[model samples]
Target chain A: MDTHAAYKSRWLPWVLLLPSFVILLVFLYYPTIETFVLSLFQVAFLGLSKSFVGLENYKILFTDPDYRQIFKNTVVFAFFVVIFSMAVGLALSVLANQRVTGWRIYRLLLIWPYALSPAVAGVIFLFMFNPQSGIVNYLLEISLGVAPDWLTNPTLAMALLVFVAVWKNVGYNVVFYIAGLQNLPGEVLEAALIDGATPWQRFWRVTFPLLSPMTFFLLIINTIYAFFEAFPFVDLLTKGGPSNATNILIFNIYRDGFEYYKTGMAAAQSVILFIAVVFLTILQFRLGEGRVHYGG
Target chain B: MKRLVTVIGLSALLGFAFAAEKVQITFWHAFGGGRTAFIQRAVEDFNYTHPGIEVKVEYKGSYRDTLNAAILAAKQGNAPHIVQIFEVGSQLAIDSGIFVPIQDFVPAGLEFQLDDYIKPVANYYRIGGKFNSIPWNSSNPILYYNKDIFKKAGLDPNNPPKTYNEVVQACEKIIASKAAPKCITWPLHSWFVEQWIAEQGALLANNENGRAARATDVYINSEAMKRIMKWWKGLYDKGYYAYTGKPEDWDGANQLFVSKQAAMEITSTSDVTFMQNASFENGFELGTGFLPTADGVERNGTVVGGASLWLTKGHPQKEQEAALTFLLWFTNTENMVRWHKGTGYFPVLNTSVKVLEWQHWFERNPAYRAAFDQLLQSKANRATQGALIGPFPEVRTIIENMIQEIFQGKDLAKALAEADAKADQALKRYNASVKK
Candidate 1:
């Protein structure tokens, strides 16, 4: 008996893949290649005037202190958002996994923020966190007797962004973790229980190891989301200001390209961002996947 | 069923015939919120009267976004017939080589005299004695204060601050009396800095504020700039000035004032109507004053702070002609008065000013007169004509960031020096990139 399953015609596979291939080519590959090409040239008048500048744009990017600060800011932002969102999500998922009354409603409420676009979330949070008139400051002043400037202070602004980002993404991580919890083998948990393991030990030794695959998956997803999807939040809320404290790579790209009309420089920055994210993802897969216990 | 099909086909054919006869042109603009509706209504009115031409107007985000979109569209050979560009983008628009100077069509004749436009506004857009763009919605900064707060602070409500020192003194009184949490606020913007620099009769860049030739240098560290920064920084240090901590946050500054968080604000003259309504709703008597100059300065006035209309290249002759007609009509005396009534923007035409004077419009609404007086009193000089830099948008951000750094306790001299260096570099790069 042949183990191989084959299509009747080779054209069928090509036909089936054509739509997605065309989309990827048009939207992704073509722009990526064009950006790389444009990165090597000095562009003006929306590329009506141009000169080949080799790696001059890249040289400027790497040497600029502002760009370096932006890189550091992005890394710190992504790290906080990923770590906190996943940690809170896991803790909530573990608690919510219990067979409690109205568990469905609890889960539904927890997942609602994931439905809002990042821009909308930014607008809502911007209003709530306004230093002078916001409800957040009002409550804080009344309760704590000290209202910190949430937007003007650099550290507070970064913290606020991280906090809002985590809040926005925690629901998404919870959805995944809840599914991962449902798939956990009951026998192993029961065995751990019978062996006199504490609740914490059960989570750490058995359940955690079993959920490594899901955690690893969410790690990659969260990292990418924190890197790229935070543009709208930055634009709507901070505009990457308060002394460039919140300026991230994506918002900087937009400011340079669209606002400043430095298209070549923005393209160079894009290429750098693209490389950084790709390398980061690849690094994660290489070091992370080997430890993920997929078989349970 | 056959009769219904015939009726539908006949109507569709008629619709196509009617559309084919109309000379349709697209106009892209940067006005949002209430202004978008006003422009749409104006376009509808224009379309109703001019059955031969159809003007399709689009609100394309902010000033920066609209300019970028226009350039990108023009690159793809689909440029809008008319693009509204803000004051800062004027140099870039002229450098883009994408627009046909409105002056080229001047000989075709406008019913209204071009000289009737306000001098400062006309001066700003008239590059090398040629009208590069049609000035529209011109404005300058004016001081807005709450009379209730002034009265509470034991300061005269009719007499607002007239100089930087006086503003500071008034703020001190207001804060000391607990009339407001903060004394004053303004959008931490570069435009105000430009205005202050102009007020001192100082140029912002070399070569006559970049009017005589392409600007290759910026005077960010000039004495005028340092003086302005020193005064501004002093306010922030004294805890008298409040801001939303975001750059160019005009609406945020307005919010602080209307909510009584701040006693006074310096914002665009274009906000007169909004300020009136806000004062009424908030139950405060509003007072408008000239933008305060530095103490002991002669007060050479402010540059225009609003957008203008530019005609794009590559449109058909008929469309270009139609766009020119629409622009002239939009800026005509009657429409100028209507625009001034609808929004607080200056009626750029002298005839419109006469009409308003004839109607005693200023007597009924004195706040609108403050801005117009400020503009009319501005000296005709290089400084008051405003700076022209190819990379002005970038230079503006750099200055805003520098000011933010200063607010965060950066050394004023060091920050200004660094900003100067950066602005000059930007100018050099911009000059290199764009061919004259």
Candidate 2:
């Protein structure tokens, strides 16, 4: 409570945390502010000269239908990835919770998809779905007597991307869900069973309600992953292809930034994406607050 | 005790004072697999001949990756002495001011024999009559076909597709015969599309395909492009052609061709060795031809696609001299012939070609001469000179996406028009930023 005593404690903590704070400020905050500033100017390769455009880049982004489509695709991708991953993850977690044979192996198998890099996963999917040589087509031809070009069809391409995203991410989500489910009190479930509740009733009234926090966490993380981390797959597999069906926001950013060298436009798109993600996250938190149950 | 202490101290001091004998120069390349091994061998040969200079060659991913890494490293003052940059990045590298022009090091008027190099290859690196970089590995697109499938389909294996219509007919025959599911597999590279346009005597960009000046606008939605797109769409509709997903999916396409799933493939000449080697197991003979033309139009030329060696700035005088020496040695007649034979890339220097001819290497292997013939047959026209747009890499992606959309049954004209407009906007942005 004395001035010297308070200063000693405060100064000690500040000194201990200085290096980390400096790193965050230099790497994260500095680049973020610099990007915002760069967004207002026209930047070029081979030179440091930049001229202020003052909202012109943003105007172009707004007027351009390509950017609008990319924005929509990104949002839609994030939505489907979050919802489906959570649904599949929750279902798998509940299934694994049952005292069944080989559940450990099932759990391990579920998590294995997460270990493969997205680029490798994209290549594997490409081969598996190749119209001529792929097993998918072989089975389709054998069973249905018809095979469709999955990568070349616009609708099917979008669906394939969403399927790959869920496939790659659901495992990680299941791991989190299992941890959450295992932490729930056994007595509470036993009480429900003693009350003569059916399995569906117990899950709907107790287990599902208790898993909300885990669901919320998975929702945020999966949404971000779908938005950013899925770009590599798009780059490698579809390349935002089949007529821009799979061209999400991050892929557009990469194309504009590195491929096109349109840094200002890319920066503008990035800012918009950042704001969109922030808004969605806030909305998720606001809606989740009413639904998520935290068991003390 | 004092005498033993003095003897031990002398040896310790001597060991600590002596520095390593070699001066290590980092060389960043885009080569991988067998080509990477070839480059490593070349570096080892250089190291063996020149004991003082130890070249440490590192594969910094692909062409795009190496350029990006080099640019970033230059900003951080840690760039490699020599960086391998793809042709698309030539202008960007030249404009960066981070590279020391090869012309600057080689004595002026001393006759590095600029004329001895292939015209187009030399022209790619020359800006305002000064060489910006040295052409290391050069390749052009050519048609590769599965001869077994051709023969199986009752088509002449010796006579490959010469026109667009013939290509389609051949595809239909292959498909009808059930010899191959798809008649051909096209790699999704915009450069290929550009080459196709040029080969038909059409321009994809203004200013003679940007050879005379920097391209500020795109003219890709022209009649020639539309015709090519229509042909492509027809092939796709008939299930005659298959898309290989990405530009680097040549290996997948090669596998499909070798496995008898596809009858034809048109890829870089650099893939010749791979095709030949893979054909051994399948017992399918490999056939090579020039890319097909549209209607009665004669084949103008195909543009080159490969990486060149760039000398980055900020090295000491001795280091610059060392880099110059390495470049000279690497591009010398003997080394160039060795590189050309080892890898499928055509030698950039005339002397190397002559040396190969003198050695009767070409006579022994006639299939390896198609790329050289195509390059020589090409006239010095604006259409065949290649594009030098500021945002070419990005523009290429847009064009590729447009083609993909067309393949997915989108209206070809509308897609191309939209791509053209978007590319124009991108070009404007690029121009506005770079304009003096």
Candidate 3:
């Protein structure tokens, strides 16, 4: 990989790679280390009155029922957001891949929601589904004669948060799915058609197997997105309650560290969340390793 | 030639040193929306009058946002010279050690007495024997109602509810009359709960509300709280109340009131002007009164509900003096009256109230008198003095969540007990973090 002329010193590659390593050390390793140290100490504003607590913060967090409930909430929220967004994205991509008039416009429109920031997505969904003056409630009342409070009812609130997260993320997933669909070889599908196979049969036996790599890649990305990026919707919408109904881990961490100013507790929550995301990512990679088929 | 040049250089340097200059200081506040105009005008007036010092005001979003910003800025050694922190955050601000007490920062030549501040409003900010921050734009909760809705419901608008039981009776009448879909609606705010507790002369936290010392216990499960929570849950169960969901959704409740979905609401006295305008614009009669207290008990007053001006430390003494000078100037009798008239907050100075009364200001605007009387008539007891726990805002959130759970049909006693234990844990954690 080295393109430069041979150098006398063995330290040349190390010197060239030092900048990125240092950047990682400062921004990533530094904060991680600080979080571990902070998780063991009770501290507040400007690091004043830091006292060593010997993992007391973690013990309290683990022992608390509310914190455990929050962990379960995070896992359930991530699972729903990832699976729903990916499934909807795949279905939409299949529809958009057809050679029809205005298909280009449809594809462009399908990919547009990916451009919205999570906070903006939150606000748009909030206004659109707002219990008071939202058009969705207005329409539901007019047509169905019932308007459920989408942001307040515990089950509906969680469902709406997941729905909005999926809606915001499906566009990004669509772009990848469309690429995967286009990259499939035409010969296999054509042969399947001649062998008296149905289109559904062709898709399952021929097309889906070839699309596994994209699916595998998207699984990891979607899991991470749902775990980390989806909390903004919860933050802007419910603030983790109508009684802690939507208290996802990350939102709780923010409440702990920023809102409540319990830095030690927040840091411990962060460390736990980091482990969760890492574990989820590793699980996806291991589970998908054999199933992700390479090109023929 | 060398001697002449040297003398000219030294003379120029000495003249520059002797010249008077205005020390510019930044004041960060949390007022926004229509309130921005009033504060901006005040800053302009201060700048125009006090040419020796310049006061620049920045609206730093909500009280929490401003406090968080100030905390981070203090860490970076560049906090604003003055920060307006809401009353709930006072204890946290005090413990942050980022402030120079108002007593120490008052200009030496000025004869300003902290005693001049209104008793209840000033009481919340004074810890020990000293005022940590100057009370600015203080408010108390009051009952606001749609008089037209009352008349429609065959209830006398002039005779509003004076107790929680009476509130239920009034709400029942309103509901039966079908004048409003709900008899009452309010944001699920813990502030109102705190006020209700204080109305019974109950401490929110032990250790004299953290005034005598750091509070390790909260009175969330006390008899007073139990009674209040029972009534609150009754309101929900009897279909007499509707909640706007979030504890901070005060604006939504305001919409419900003005839109005629709710007949009555309890809100900050500072919102009196806004509610009045909404009432006028929406074509409803606005009636104001002291917030309802429990019947059969002598009603104590509510705690103060607004921000205070804090002079930040780590600045040059001259800047501190200039900031304090502007703080004094900005809160003088005339300015306080101007602020009280502009916003429905208290004048915060006895002299200012005296001036307004003499000027027939309250006479012309009779609506202002309700809050004025509510706060001024308060007895200076520990309950009305307001709690000084370091984690008050977070504890308030726990109380809010408990109320939400109760409204959702959770067992009131269990929720309150659990919430109290959780709040005590939070307070203990906060106390440990800040202990030296």
Candidate 4:
């Protein structure tokens, strides 16, 4: 027998990979490279005119106070949306995992918001938290006699966005958690329980470590969701207003490019966003690898 | 092979059944809901009246989105024959070099008179002393108030506030009456600010509101703006104003008015029909008035708020002619009446106004008439001509942001200065790019 098993035809593997490679190159790589190239030029006349203006767009990004504020807002938006959603998601998943009656229904209800697109989610939250007319404020006034202005106040608006982002994604994380929990070895858990370990201790010592891989995977996916997929939410709900308080990176690019017709600036902003997301995912993998346990 | 032949044969047969030699044309607009129905009616009527040409209409999201799509389409050589661009995009449309001036199609197979168009409606679309696009649907901002709230607040329902100072006094009274939590509701739209600046006989940007020449600087830090901003801030500070803080929340303001959360509101005249429905549903009598001016200055008037139709280049001459003919008929006195009565937009032609006057339409529909009067009373000045610039939409966002900051307690003068600088820079960049 040969030491290595090989494909019947080496060309078959390349042929099999060709479809995916073509799709990725056309859909992803081409646009990404185009953005990088366009960022170095001044594009106008509806993309008919292009002039090389190296580093000028980036210089404006670095110099303009509005751009600076928007960039900071993006970082803050991504940081809060990812960290808080994952934490809440973990908590919800654990609660949903309990052996209780109606838990399945509860889980189903928790996952409902995940079915909606970012625009729909934004609309749902917008109607729910509307200051004067929303049910949330109505109930708040009925109970406490005070309803905080949900959209007008900058802090509250950002917090509301984070809440909605988490609300929409928590179910996704919960599903993974449930799968991870189901795969936990019964013998190990029984051994821990028979040793008189408390329920919380069992979860921390055995269950949590076993679920680390799922958590690590989710961290990467949720970060991308918060960074790029939240454009429609911002556009539909806040439109990057109340002093540009909720103007995150993606929506800012849309407003600058599509709405304002500043192609070069938008391309530059896209590159910056790409770099930030890449750096963030890489940082997470490096710092988080030690904590992920691959149990035997 | 048999199936492929059958499919090709069926498609050719279908093509012969319709639109074979009709010179099909596409019209792009941003209207939905009720307005979309209006467009469909016109399209049906046109198609029925002229069997030689067929036109299809597509709604492309909103105004900004539609304009972006149209521009990109032009670049790809697939542009539509007709596009409805909002009045603010006039300059960009002209600079686009993508349209054959509808003016070039003058004497467009009809007894069309350019002067018959309402002055303010024509003023915004006229470039280089020629109408670049046909003014289609037009609107102006007007003050809308709750008559019952005004009456309760000791302000006469028949007589609304007419000056800036009067408005403040009325708002104070309304708040003191405790009928609503706030005296008035305001949307953070830069259009209103632009209108107010014009009402005070002051231009929003230098170079004759960007009409005489390309604007190099924005006059946002003027005394009028500071005074207006200071007054606006005072209302919020005094708890006499309600703000939702979403920049384009026109519907939100309407809700405020209908729910009695605010006594007064300012919005496009195109909203009159919707306001009537709200009034019927909410059990409040809606009163209308001209937008109040700064205390001592005469109210010059307002710029048009609706959109217009342009005959795009690159379309076949026959298609462009058909599109222009559709527009000419679309704005004729009869269709104008239908459009104005149906949509609450201004009747773009004076002949339509005469017909409405003769029909006692104004008396029957007083709120609509208030807007008509507001436009007729407008002074032909640069301020009222409206700002025409390539980067107008961005400058508007900057002004909207500065306004929001001011409302959030940013220093008024500093915010104005910052907004002015941002707007000027946007204009400079835009001018530089299109300089060739």
Candidate 5:
């Protein structure tokens, strides 16, 4: 009877998990496996005829300078986006947590950018930074006596893209940070304050340490978001433009796959990107284990 | 009593069986807005005239999107009976082997009087002396200028810039007079670029812009192209031009023109309706002119920019016949005249032009005659023929990138050379893959 009961309990958990398991297998694993298979062959709109060209697509991707530059650009874009987003999100969350007047309104205004679609945000940025007639340039010229071609300048274009990405995404991180801040034990902060710790001292020594788990979570999530989610803005605003300065890995993958119809090459590039993201994520987790505090 | 009831039922069934089969043919097109209404009207008329057949038309987004969707669907065995592929995609569609030749559907030995079609327009759809698809709603790029802006800039409103030098001079005057922020605007489209190259009688690609056959090489970095790029670069350097950055940013340029902020704009003749309907603050009148030419170079004809109706394979003989009948009706003279008058597209049938002339429509709307006259007067040269590159959409993106580079102050010659190298590599790969 006990063995039967144990078996029933074991099957019950699986039965409860069955729906999610099937959903993941169908939606995620199936497409991933198909994409992997497609990567081994040359596919087009005409028809799919597979011929074994083992590692040939990978060779082409690795040998191409454009792909290398695109990889570097993507890494750079992601790094800047994550760093800027975390900094801004943390600051905004901390400020909102303070018992200031109308703090809720400020918080609402701060996180409002997260509500915008990336494509719409990209258009708004494009108009705001347009060289000829953008409001940003107009303001800059009138106040600072300088108006640079923000989109046309290769050096500034990527920076502008990172700025836009952070502006649009930092609000999402702020929500996470605010939750982390609110969930913190009040006794720990009160104890630190009673022990002659100042506000900055308490934040740096106690509060920041307690928020390490949240910081780690935000880091991983923001990195992935920067890698994949920020690509549409780059496509819409710059089109990997100003002499391919803004071309990132996923954008290059899209250009090669859909626009150029170089399916195998794009798949190979995607595999590379996947491997890189996995490696970075593992490294982040490994590094954060020593620093992250799970409890007060 | 049973026998009497059975006899009555059998007679009723026989009477119902004698009724015609409701033939349904699916037509996928990229037409929307006013053009969609015109096509819907044509479908309604065709259905009314032919009691047995019903044509179902579906709007499938832009020309490129429609072609991509149809090609994908054809591979999956779900393609429509008829698809409206753009002119550039015609070669790709023909090479794909999924479409049934229109000539094959028509009765054998029944000459369709192919000579009735305008030579250049019909020749575009012809592959080795056999027409592949029926050309419909064809248009060419033309210059659209604001007369009020021209007057303010001290330029002749009637006689717009004819030569490239004159265009530059007029742009400068317009800018200097503060009539417009930028004197002129050109939408960044490959078709328009090809048209400009053809206007200078420069070959865009080998093999007669690939009309003779499929192109394996791109001549985008030729001397004439370099010259044109240099001229555009000069204009950009002088602040007489502005790049909208987005390929679909013609709305901004149109707004600029309508607001009397831009003196001149070059776009498709199809944009005539949009320009005509735009509410202008200063009440500007539009001036239509032929595309400008370089000094001492005659203007070559602009290539067709609209979509054509393609018949897909894998349909019953009756359905095929019904599709062909629909195509014939869609391109008939009266239908063509109605389509042309309704949309800004020039009628594909010469008889439709004659009919319009008889009706005094062209006399009342003289601006609409500019594209027709320009096309008719153009010499049938290889340069003026359209590009038929296999991976043309990809090639266009590459060219757009090169243009962006130029806008960023890259050396035009070097940039074009690099772009040419990349495009040739792409062409070679595309040609090899498409090879039987």
Candidate 6:
């Protein structure tokens, strides 16, 4: 078979791609452009009224202390979630990859958290960490003679959100890493072993470098997850509460748009969040392009 | 086989004809759990009794979600015939221009008994001397205390705290006696602040609580709010207040009280039935009282905090009429009594209250008496009617977050100032957008 089919008509190729392009235009491009335009206006009464105010919405975002705090919270939350999930995911994947008798069961158990939606996970954690009657507090009171307020305390709330996000996302990361581990050229690691390299050195100098491509891919996936997919956890658990301590950007957008009916402000927030994730992803790619060691 | 097929086809045709003859109207409400079941039962009764109208009831997620869904659906020209909007969303609902004031649907000289409705509730939903929506489920906050804890602390179980000083004194004895881990708890909700401000006979916003004009400023930083916050902060500082740490965590507060972790909780009267069940389940005696007010301030009564049913515009005349019929029947005296008995919400009809009193309903459910007495004792004022603001939900969230910040050691003055600024900004944007 020919490596590439040479179409005789240029319009034919365009026509063939029309379906996907149209879908992207309708679902992706139109909404993004609409959100950008809507962000310039002050929308009221669930968009029964709208008046353009130029960059007033964006200016508010820049000047508003609450929005600034949310932005900082998002960054901090994303950083911790990405780092911890990836590290824990890699460790778990390595263990699951071992040729132990119950390795299948271990993998299945480790991957079950990924099957639960963020909202469900949030609900589970919410009951467990409830300050009044949650099992966590009940157990702590029994053992430590002190029960910390889990959902209400600002620091603890944020920490709990990060913890839940990492716990939910680690399974996803582990799945990818396991596939990456199975695909790694065993000969390279074996050569390192034969050349008198220690197990740790073999991992860092050979196996780790070989898995860079997977790591790069996981980095982008985890960052996007942290940015957007972490919303439900915050919503179900904290509701961006206890003084906006755990209020991430996405949750703030939801509150403004859906709860408060401040569509224009929420649209403005959406644009900012979009730009932030795009910039972060681009930065990840630029950095990864230099370091990712793709094997021949 | 041919005979069976013929019979099935005929029945299908008949079913379609039957469904088409009825004026179908959809009703979206914000009730969940057992209350949803109660609403379903009422709607079924309505459907069963009114054969010409098929009232389809839907359980929308929450008051905010229901209102938003209605507005969005209205924009799409698929709005339900009726939507239950919280009292705080009254201004927004009216300003949306998508709802037909229920008064418009009232036939002239029909003896609709509009005047028979309770003053506070009617006042809350009525704008410009006309009811914008039919007041349905209405509630006010009341104090729920564990009588056993009160007795354990040597405080009179029957007589609950009525003022901030009395609450603090009670808390002192309760804490000193170690009856419970905390003395009191309430959802860190802005509703309480609004109620307390009303209790002090202070308006939450200018222009007669936005009844005279569109609200442009919020009184979050006013002296009235300061007094409320100071008292609240004092309890927090003294470690007598149980801080659930979440904003608007009504269930958490309820748990703290029901589980005997806290001796008292101030929550909505709608939770009266829940409290009764919880006290039974948790093996405690529940006592109810009027929500405590600031010291030395004459109580002005709490505002109505539940929702009302609004008729959406753009429906067919038949559907609209059917929706009006459903709304009227849903809030009629008989149904109101049933609603009150089923849920702890106020029976918003004077006739319903009369019937309940005549029936001696309150004697059996004495805990409900506290809520009813509080509502009756409330003076009809702009504050008690509650503030009408376009951005009420946002302003509430800000106030709640501010309270949380203050609880976490943020300077009270700074938190109030910040909350006031944010609330005013929201009001400005809302007013501007609606003005255009």
RMSD to native for every prediction?
1.6, 2.7, 3.6, 2.7, 3.8, 2.0
What tens-digit string does per-residue lDDT give for candidate 6 at B85-176? 99888898889999987887876663366788898887887898899888888999999999999999999999999999999999999999
TM-score of each: 0.97, 0.94, 0.93, 0.96, 0.92, 0.96
True contacts kept of 1: 0.73
lDDT of each: 0.91, 0.81, 0.86, 0.86, 0.80, 0.89
Ranking, DockQ, top scorer first: 6, 1, 4, 3, 2, 5
For model 3, the stretches where C-alpha displacement exceeds 4 angstroms are A1-3, A6-22, B1-20
- Candidate 5 Cα misplacement greater than 4 A, ranges: A1-21, A145-147, B1-20, B107-114, B279-282
lDDT of 2 by residue, A130-196 (tens): 7678899899999999987777777787888899999999899989999998999999999999999
Error of 2 at B51 (Å): 3.4
Candidate 5 vs candidate 6: which has greater TM-score?
A: 6
* Tens-digit lDDT string for candidate 3 (A1-296): 78555876889989989999999999999999999899998878637558888889999888999999898899889999989999999999989999999999999999998998888988778777766566898899999998777766788889988999999999999999999999999988888999999978987898889999999999989988988887788877888888888889888888888778888888999999888889878888898887889986
User: Which order, best to worst by TM-score?
Assistant: 1, 6, 4, 2, 3, 5
lDDT of 3 by residue, B223-303 (tens): 888888888889988978765555577877887788887899888888878887888999999988888988777888888
Tell me the spans in candidate 6 whose CA falls farther than 4 Å from its real position.
Answer: A1-16, A142-145, B1-15, B109-111
Full ranking by lDDT? 1, 6, 3, 4, 2, 5
Better of 2 and 6 by lDDT: 6
**Tens-digit lDDT track for model 2 on B2-56?**
9999999998878655425556688999887878888888899998999778788
Q: RMSD of candidate 5 to the true fold?
A: 3.8
Docking quality class, candidate 4 = medium
Q: Model 2 scores what on Cα lDDT?
A: 0.81
lDDT of model 3 at position B176? 93
- Per model, the share of native interface contacts recovered reads 0.73, 0.50, 0.52, 0.71, 0.29, 0.79
Q: What's chain A's TM-score in each predicted model?
A: 0.96, 0.95, 0.95, 0.94, 0.93, 0.95
Q: Give the per-residue lDDT digits (tens) of candidate 4, residues A65-173.
A: 8888898888888889889888888888888888899998988988888887878788878888878778998999999999888888899889888788888888898
Cα shift from native, residue A30, model 4 (Å): 1.1
Clashing pairs in 5: none
Candidate maximizing DockQ: 6
lDDT of 2 at A128: 88
Q: After superposition, how far is residue B231 of candidate 6 from its true place, in Å?
A: 1.4
Report residue B98 deviation for candidate 1 (angstroms).
Answer: 0.9
